[model samples]
Target: MVTPPSYESRQFERRPGIRPRQTLGRRLDAASRAALPAAIAVVLLLLLHAPLGLPAQPALLLGAELACVFYWSLFLPRVMPSPVVFVLGLLVDLLGTGPLGLSVVLLLIAHVAGIAWRQALMRQGALVIWLVFAGVAALCCLIEWLATMLLEWRLLPPGSAALQFGFALGEYLVLSGPFAWCMRVVARPHG
Candidate 1:
């Protein structure tokens, strides 16, 4: 007859609390992943306010913010949480000349829209994504304009808002490629 090992010897619970430690590279990777969203937001802010002599309207800036939030939310929702989105929008509001909470609300809406449509959108091609983004940008601009009008208690001209919308949509096309590349570099998982 062969002797069997004791229960205590075989039980993993009996061992010391020697959990597997992550390697330094893995730790750094996780830290970078966590910081990436804010970093991207900051970069977008810088680009939005860069002294390029181009007029940086609230709509255009929000569109840039939308690109960041939208890309991250679609690709890495776990990294771009609601709180992060809110903070980024708040920072944009503080840094730019926009109504307080305007960026916050619009960005949050864009973030949520990204999350909601991510699955369907991800399956589609690049052109479809841009089309969808155009629709979201339009809706966000409309809501922003309406909110400003309601809060200010004055009828702002629709022409300027419409112009902003067109500029924002155009700007998105100009910026989306770089934004997507950044998203890939930041959100890519490490082995």
Candidate 2:
């Protein structure tokens, strides 16, 4: 019996352990992978303003986005550009009744600080990373408090500003795991 010509085609060849190809619609391309961090930033920003009925929800979400921005900016600068950070910060300012341009400046500074310390952070352990984050969050909170005071022409209680710093640090700890996982697994467009 002669095999049909179609039967002898390359498609007939079977590779062991490899499944048939499927649609790539579910897979993100390199550009999309690079944009994932920024996309996450947007989502977190939106959630920041959501009325979740929880006290300090806004602070928590802001902390989350700040952590997201810092991590991606440090590890994947292309994924989290300065403009995206600026926009998120702007949104925070717009959505809240805080001082205008305050978050924008803080976020931009955080993004820059992450970039500036990227190389050094890359070689460090989790402790060092956490310490550096603590410093950055502290500086940002301090700036925010000072800016608010200057804009309002009076001293406001530092409690909330200090709370913001605390939230940022806590969120960073919570988010670092997922961030690492995404960089190692989900963001790999090549595979």
Candidate 3:
């Protein structure tokens, strides 16, 4: 009769590390999954550029930025990545009359900041998320104002940047709960 393996032998058995093994099929699947959100963001950005004259006025630009931030940071941070963020910002810069790298830098900064804060924010609920979004919007507006001042050598009128920033803040405030709920729905582990 054979004896059972000892506990020490079982304990020493080689086990895989935390990282999943990469395979061609898995990589392709990930790429495929990522395409949908990226394409949606691009199409939405283009539609925003279409000049349909949404009665909200100049806040439209702020709305676009808010959507980008929410999509890239909170929604699909891993799939979209930094290069996509930079490119999106570049497109915004080109579409708007702003300084060349303004949007690019702003988007990058915001994305990185969001990732850095993500862990702590994840522990909180919808209200905290809304507050974080407001903080991010305010920071982005400040950065945009500084860029404009440095590049254009002029300050925006009192209500100018504030209005735009308020629009962004409001967008986030209005949508944060729904977006968070959707994120949970989409992120549920499937088999």
Candidate 4:
């Protein structure tokens, strides 16, 4: 013979005196996941401004921020919408002493390109992906240089832009691995 569990044992209910509490972590978890990508972009942007003894000043791969935007845009376009991209660009502009809207425009362009290339990038090899990124970075650096010169009304040295492009490519090479890992962890199905 088998014994059935009592009703009280199987049917526990909260009394009026008991109330649900929302911890900070729980509250944050309740937020939409869409913010995750933008948050990462902000963190990466902050790291760029931090005193890491790395040459962030004077155009030492300003593409760090762009890299973050491009990576997320390419992999998970839905999570990172245009408004988030716009905010990230504003953050970059505020973090450094540069033209305010320059990053906004550049990041928006990267976002668009990444979205357009997402399908192709899915089937490409690592080298091809890196080459595509190199092209995007170069375009960003060139635009940045041209904008700076246009704003200042002077012919800024081209060498600086060239150096920035090289450093951007290097930044992509170093950061892409970690970015990919983060994407897997964050974007995985929550089942």
CA-lDDT, candidates in order: 0.78, 0.80, 0.66, 0.78
Instruction: State the TM-score for model 4.
Output: 0.78
Runs in model 2 deviating more than 4 A are 1-28, 189-191
Per residue, candidate 2 scores C-alpha lDDT tens digits across 128-149 of: 9889888988898899789878
Candidate number that wins on lDDT, 2 or 3? 2
TM-scores, each model vs. reference: 0.79, 0.81, 0.72, 0.78
* Cα displacement (Å) at residue 87, model 3: 0.9
Tell how far residue 41 is off in model 1, in angstroms: 1.6
Best by lDDT: 2
The true-versus-predicted C-alpha distance at residue 99 of model 1, in Å, is 2.3
Candidate rank order under lDDT: 2, 1, 4, 3
Any idea what lDDT model 1 has?
0.78
- 1-191, model 4: which lDDT tens digit per residue? 98675333244332345645778875566354557777877777876687888653546537777777888888777678899889888888887788999989999988998899998998998888789888898899999999999999999889988988888888778878887776666553331
- Between 2 and 4, whose TM-score is larger? 2
Model 3, 138-169: lDDT tens digits are 88888777777877787767566787788887
* TM match of model 3 to true structure: 0.72
Which candidate has the top score in TM-score?
2
